[model samples]
Target: MAIHFFEEDIRSEIQQKRNLKNWIKKVAAGKSFRIGNINYIFCTDEYLLEINKAYLNHDTLTDIITFDQSERFGEIDADIYISAERIRENADILGKTYQEELRRVLIHGILHLCGHRDKSPAEKKSMREEEDKALNLFDSADVPRGTLKK
Candidate 1:
């Protein structure tokens, strides 16, 4: 299971590919069964908006959009598009940093691939709980991973 991160930022920030890859592997170790290929595209909201419209038929702003391309041959091919712009906006709205919101969104997508759905009110609540659990595990420190509330 390889987690590949592609940054489309003209001015690349402090995203460490190795650390992010390790985190992904740790989170997906026994879940999702990511085997062959997994791609994460980090970009601006404009880019993700275009992707949302083109791929999902939704023309609204979102933080992350995941496309499962896994075939019957067990090749887990998938694309997860993350919107940094929306993350920043959401972080401000939730009184957290961009990193916090980004991490939450990142785990949200991973849980999605792990058969976690958040389409309904109850599902959304459960998904939030799972996201918090994942974040706590991912952090494993006393500093508290994020400031966002479920």
Candidate 2:
């Protein structure tokens, strides 16, 4: 019933941790699910690359990787690993601020824990739509947008 952020090979912090938790709660409520313990691990690209390779058997580096450990429909337990370096690069490429891109990735990981997949073009589109919805939730919340960045 909590969201925790940990750093690995990196010392960055999430500026809006509390607001992000509330936003996640709203998102889970919309899906008729409950918020469980969610561990967000922020790390360097090299650190996450090792996780991707060792656990997923993938040799490529990715911005985020989620390991879902939910035991039931209404519960969620996931280990989400995010690469800070990749997020920064992606933010530049997408014309979004680093916080915005990072938020998208964080929401993307939660969406995956909620059983959303992005293996196909159609699925990818749906995932994007969900991410937008989550971001909209953030916008609608009372928190200031600038508070999302450090």
Candidate 3:
């Protein structure tokens, strides 16, 4: 279980990588999943736009784009690209702090890797519930150290 962070077209600071890794590991374990290699690439809106256009064939700017490469049920391997500018803007628009929204987006991708989707109304509700649970896991500061679940 390795979490890698990279910055492109924007060099910024991401806080508490160690703590976040721990939180994500706890979330995955709780979901009966195992953590694999996760690369978090942070970049500007333009950079993410190019990524969206090139890889997804969509000409729009989004906060995050997750490329899941997991081959099995338990393992998770993904490259999650995030647009910092969009996150900040979204934070402002949503009346939340930058850190709050950023964490939500981060764990949102992790949830997707855990097989949570938000395409439909019911799926979106379930995904949001899972996101809230995962967020609460971090907020409570009582994470377990159990091995990854099968």
Candidate 4:
């Protein structure tokens, strides 16, 4: 049951990692799944674009790409790649603070592992609702606001 964060070519780190980890565990448990070895790799948009092209065969920029690696049925193990640059741009476009957008992307990937999909309009709405619930869990707890270095 481990959640590790790494930087590929980004200049930022996740603040309050302990609290974030606990929150992630709780989110997974809420879906009746246990946490496994999950690695979050933060990188530049270009880096993530290369991955998107090479692996997913999509030649476009995306905020996140989740690779589910869970072996057991009820455990979540995956490598989630995030584009910090994209997140910042999206934050500005959505009129949200960087921290708020980052947290959304973070939980978005986890929610994917929890059997949530966003391919359709209804699924996207449901996914957003789940993301909001997870975010509320973080907000209503004793956790401090998380930040990323610029």
Candidate with top lDDT is 4
| Candidate 1 residue-wise lDDT, 1-150, digit = tens | 576767886222435445555566666664745545788788998898898899889999998998888774334568888887788888899999776787788778887877889999999999999888877766775333333321
Error of 4 at 81 (Å): 0.3
**Which whole-number lDDT from 0 to 100 does residue 102 have in model 1?**
77
Residue 33, candidate 1: Cα error in Å is: 2.3
| All candidates in order of TM-score, best leading | 4, 2, 3, 1
TM-score on alpha carbons, each prediction = 0.81, 0.92, 0.90, 0.93
Q: Report the lDDT tens digits of candidate 4 across residue range 88-118.
A: 9999999998878988999999999999999
Backbone clash total, candidate 4: 0
| Residue-level error in angstroms, candidate 3, position 102 | 0.8
Sliding window of 10 residues with minimal summed lDDT for model 3: 141-150
RMSD of 3: 4.9
The alpha-carbon lDDT assigned to residue 150 of candidate 4 equals: 31
lDDT of 3 by residue, 1-150 (tens): 698888887864577667778888889888898889999999999999999999999998899999998988899899999998988999999998887888899999999998899999999999989998888987784854343321
**What lDDT is obtained when candidate 4 is compared to the true structure?**
0.90
Ranking by lDDT: 4, 3, 2, 1
TM-score winner, 1 or 4: 4
In candidate 3, which residue ranges exceed 4 Å CA deviation?
A: 143-150
Cα shift from native, residue 101, model 3 (Å): 0.6
lDDT, each prediction:
0.74, 0.86, 0.87, 0.90
Off by over 4 Å in 4: 142-150
* Cα distance off (Å), candidate 4, residue 143: 4.6
